[model samples]
Every structure is written in structure tokens, then in C-alpha cells.
Target: QQQVKQSPQSLIVQKGGISIINCAYENTAFDYFPWYQQFPGKGPALLIAIRPDVSEKKEGRFTISFNKSAKQFSLHIMDSQPGDSATYFCAASMRGGNTPLVFGKGTRLSVIA
Candidate 1:
């Protein structure tokens, strides 16, 4: 149970619109959930994260909704923009530990002008 799967290999949204991506995991042992955003030729950066202890987390325009019982999570972007276009990856891992994160195949988000 060490897999995280994401859908919509690509997404197209208009500027000032909302963008959503979903992810599912199979490992119950995983306690840390993080969504990363990556631009072209750059490493992914932690956009937002949520732990099993919390049902949801939000930072600015980014929000992460988590469901422990369902072992799933999703990222929501409010007011999406062309500048916000990037590859998003949902990941899971153990908390306060060095366990490698399991990443989704990735969803390429494009915001049209």
C-alpha cells in the first residue's frame, strides 16, 4: 500500500477560473500529505500540505482537502491564472521521518489567457 494515483494527466482552465485535481492513496500508514507544484525545468515546491489529523488546509489561493477514511485528497486553486500553470503532483509520506514520498504521475495544468 504505497501508491498514490492522480488523474487528468492534463487540465486546461481559463484565467480567473478554478482548477481542481484529485489523488488517491492506498497506504494507511502514511500520515503526511503534500501537494507540489513544479514549473518547467524546475524542482517541485511544496504548495500546500495536510496531515491526517486535519481534514483540510488552505494557504492563500491554494487549498487541500483530505479524507482519511477514503484515503484520498484533492487540490483546489481559486482564481487560476496563466502564471499558475504548472505540473502538480500529490504525494504522501510518514511524518517527521525520512521516508521517501510517493508521487502521482503528475497533472499538467494550463491556464489560458
Candidate 2:
């Protein structure tokens, strides 16, 4: 089974709407939870991240809500835009700066104008 389960393989939202992506992990040892955004023909870029101690984190129009007890995390994009349409991924990793992350299947979001 996948380490991280992501919901809604794809999504379509009108411009200025909110885009939400959810993920759940089965491993409690995972301490780093991050969300990545990727545009076509480019590598995934780190959008936002949260640790187990943090319940929520926000950067610009992006936000991450984490539930340590539930081992789940979600990403919300405020005011979705056409330029924001891309593939979003949720990832989990141990407490290592040079470690690779176990990523979710990914959610493709399309912001329609």
C-alpha cells in the first residue's frame, strides 16, 4: 500500500476559488510534511511545509493544515488562478536534511478562467 494516500486525483476550480488537496500517512515516525507544486515540464518545487509540532502553516496564498494525531495534512490555495493550475503533491519524510520524501500519488488541479 502507498505510504501516503492522496484524494481526488484531479480537480477543476474557477479562478479566484479555493483549491484543496488532502493527504494521509500511516507512518508516525514521519516528522516532515510538505506540499509540492509542479508545472508542466518542470521539476516539483516546494510550496509549503509543516512539522508535527505545527498545527498549521501559511505562505502567501498557500496554506498547510496538519493533524498530528490523525496523521493527515491538507493544502489550501486561496484565490486559485489560471497560473496556479498544476500538479500538487503531499510528501512525508523523516528528520533528515538530505533524505528523500515519500510522496503521495499527486493531485492535478486545474484553475479555469
Candidate 3:
């Protein structure tokens, strides 16, 4: 599979709450998993990621739980804050060669004050 699909085009959560988003991929050739956070008019920045060898990875308030068997992954934002409000994307890529990263359509997250 060469595509990663994300859901809930948008999300709204209260400050200090948890926000969750899911994604699925079809390509088994993909070896790298990365989640990116993007603000309006800015480039996406890597948030967290996990390879097929690992079940999960976390960075501060962000966590990425991956399922290799299911070909799925999710991003969990803990202690959501207004500053965390932004568009999140789940992406996949194979190392080496010219395999460009493939991204999901994106999920817009808004944390209300």
C-alpha cells in the first residue's frame, strides 16, 4: 500500500483534554512512520514516530502508537492546550532511494481555551 488515510478532517477539544486521531496505510514497503504537526501557513514538523519494530513512541505531550499487523497508527495529544491547536498529519516513507514521504489528508485540531 502507498497511501495513508486519516480521519475526522477536524477535531475540537477542551484545554487540558486529550485529542486522538487515527490513520491507516496500505503499503507494506513503508518502513518509516512519522507524525507531523503543522500550523496555519507553516510547514509540517515531525511530532513523533515509531517503526514497525516498535509498538509505540512518545515525545512530551505527544504519543504515537503504531500497529504493524493492522497497518495502522494513531496520534494522541495529552494535556491539550490552545497552543497545541494545529493541523496534524500522519506520514510514511521508506528509507534509502527516492521514496518521498506520503501524508494523510490531515486533521485539524483545535483546543478551546
In terms of TM-score, the best-performing candidate is: 1
Q: What is the Cα root-mean-square deviation between model 3 and the actual structure?
A: 1.2
lDDT of 3: 0.91
List the candidate numbers ranked by lDDT, top first. Answer: 1, 2, 3
For model 1, the stretches where C-alpha displacement exceeds 4 angstroms are none
Candidate 2, residue 85: lDDT:
92
Q: What C-alpha RMSD separates each model from the true structure? A: 0.9, 1.2, 1.2
**Which of the predicted structures, 1 or 2, would earn the higher TM-score when compared with the native?**
1
Task: Please provide, for model 1 over 1-113, each residue's C-alpha lDDT reduced to its tens digit, 9 standing for 90 to 100.
Answer: 78899988999999999999999998788999899999999999999989888988999999999998998999999999899999999999975688899999999999998
In the range 9-101, model 2's lDDT, one tens digit per residue, is: 999999999999999999887899889989999999999989999899999999999998888899999999999999999999987686789
Summing lDDT over every window of 10 consecutive residues in candidate 2, give the lowest-scoring window.
92-101
Ranking by TM-score: 1, 2, 3
Cα-based lDDT for every prediction: 0.93, 0.92, 0.91
Tens digits of per-residue lDDT, candidate 3, 1-113, equal: 68799987999999999999999999888888889999989999988878889988888988889899999899999999999999999999986846799999999999998
TM-score of each: 0.96, 0.95, 0.94
